[model samples]
Target: MGLEQIKNEFNAIAKTIYFDKAHFLREKASDEKAVRIFLEKVERLLQENDRKLEELYFVYGVFGNLYRVIGHPKKAIHYLQQALCLAERENDDSRKVVFLIRLGEALKYNEEHEKALKTFDKAMDLSDTLQVRKYNDFIFQHKGKCLLELGHLLEAEKCFLEALHIRKEKGDPELVASTELAIELVKKSK
Candidate 1:
């Protein structure tokens, strides 16, 4: 296939990977095999055409998320970092924020609180600049968690409250409740 054709095909594949109904099949459980298939498909596309660095970052981010879901924090961190670097290289603000968020989450789970805080801080800043309010609550929620881990109770509470406010504004009652719980945890720790 021509490089342009490969680009189009890769984009289509990525879209399907992200939005495919097969992914939401509760009955299939779509476990390890499905994840592997998605990974392979993306990898093959990359091998076939090497110019779509942004798409590679996206696929890496997706693979990282899957690794995170599978409870592999280290692998998730590695792939997320790859995605982050590529996103930065591509100057893609949204993708950079996404990889930062994933990297922050993985680092937070690994107890790398300081690094995670820095990563989440960048993600929050980027989200603000990008006007990505959809992800603000998530960014603040993770920032709160990282601060809480670092024993910054007051800071953690602030972050959680901010997250709660965003969730409330966004009509995400579940996240609002979760942020409230975190807020309570921070308060209790004090």
Candidate 2:
């Protein structure tokens, strides 16, 4: 019943309600209204005393992804970079790899192909060092897309093939089909 307790309870409810709504809207084809609401709620949550660093990381990461989905690569890069920094600060290599892949994709979207390739390289190295095979396919797929945009057809095909192999092993038909499409695009480009 106290002021502090009431504030805490309100924050908890707001976090769940706002974030869930934002995510649902985002999933519905990256609605612009969703981005606006998400940004507003995230700003308010960030002003609260109870925000944790992990929560901050998640918020930044999701913000970056939403921006990317909405074709705002510059904004995506900014927030994804912040998320990557937080992951590094926490010494979380797994999260670092994830953010790197996302940041690399944003960079690629912004036509910074060389920088994107470097970012993907860093992600690949870190994922390999951590023995985290789960993200290798993603790393390869994104990197391949960057290379493709840069006109490195052969290298792009190689990366896509690697991704296809991994995705096939994972037995996800959708993933396999996606990589196959990439490979076909490479072939057509040649």
Candidate 3:
């Protein structure tokens, strides 16, 4: 196969491993072994490709998210940082925002609330500068969680309310409900 064809095939396989199998394991089964298997496959693909492919950022992102699902926040943070570096090297601000959010979540999971807040703030700033409203609610919601964990209840409520407003406009019932629950938690904590 030509080099382009090989790259295409690699990207396809990586996407299936990440979006299909890994997501199913995380959401439906929560099977750490299955996730590990998929993770290893992707890692092997990265190695065989010499990590020079265009999809390296995506593969690293998949690794980070899979680590998160298996409750390995530190590992997730490492991979996410790698993904963010690759995204930055590609000059992909949109992908940078996404990686920042994922990194923030990993930090939050590891109880690094202050660092998570900083990461989320960076995501929010990038999204705003890019005029990408799609990720606004997510940034706000995750930032709210970090703030809540840090005992900044009022700030957390503000972030959750902002997220709720955006999610309501987007009409994602699940997202709206999630923000509402966060808001309720903030209120109860007060």
Candidate 4:
């Protein structure tokens, strides 16, 4: 099969793996294992043909996010950093934003609030320059997380409110409620 075909197959598998990990199943350890399996499969493909750095980064990103969700901050940050380098090399703003967000979350969980805020700032700038509205709510949410952690209660509250507004605009009551909960956290912290 050609490279495109391989990429298509990888995309399909990654989507399924991510979806299962996020929604279909609720076991973090199992989800991490499953994500690793997918990463190993992609690594083998990379071993056979190492030209597709972009594809490798994509898998690394998935691995990073899985580990992050599984409470493995160090491993998640490592893979996310790798993915961020590739994203920057490729000048792919979308991937840059995504990798930065994942890395920021991992850093925040690792108690590296300063570093996480810097990462989120870079992502926020890129998202603005790229005009990527899809990521705005999520960026705001994560930024709020960092702010909340750093004791910037007012800023955190604003971020959560902005995120909540976006969620409501999207007509996702569930997401709105979740964002509201974050707002509640900010209020409580204040």
TM-score leader: 2
The C-alpha TM-scores of every prediction are 0.66, 0.77, 0.77, 0.71
Model 1 CA deviation exceeding 4 Å by range: 1-58, 69-71, 129-133
| Clash count list over all predictions | 0, 0, 0, 0
lDDT of 4 by residue, 1-190 (tens): 3457655755654454321222212114434465566556656766687556756776677667666656678988988898888888888888888888888888887779899888888888888889866778888888887787688989988888999988889998867876777776667667
Task: Quantify all predictions' global Cα lDDT against the true fold.
Answer: 0.70, 0.76, 0.74, 0.73
Q: How good is model 4 by TM-score?
A: 0.71
Model 4 regions more than 4 Å off: 1-54
Error of 1 at 87 (Å): 2.0
Who wins the lDDT comparison? 2
Q: Alpha carbon lDDT of residue 26, candidate 1?
A: 10
- Candidate 2 clashes between residue pairs 3 or more apart in a chain or in different chains: none
Tell me how candidate 1 scores on lDDT. 0.70
Better-scoring candidate (TM-score), 1 or 2: 2
Give the per-residue lDDT of model 1 (tens digit) for 1-190.
4445534544543433321122211111235555556557656766777645645665677667666554567877988988888778878787778778889988876668788889898888888888865787788888877787778888888888888887898887767777777776777778
Looking at candidate 3, the ten consecutive residues that score lowest on lDDT are 19-28
Candidate 3's residue-wise lDDT over 1-190, tens digit each?
Answer: 3345544544544443321221211212235566666667666766776655356665677667667766788999999998898888888887889999999988887778788899999899899888766888889988887787788888888998999999999999978876777776777778
How do the residues 1-190 of candidate 2 rate in per-residue lDDT, one tens digit apiece? 3334434543443343221132211112324665556566665766675656766676677667667665688998999988888888889888999999999988877778899999999999999889876999999998987887777999999999999999999999978887887787778779
TM-score: the better of candidates 3 and 4: 3
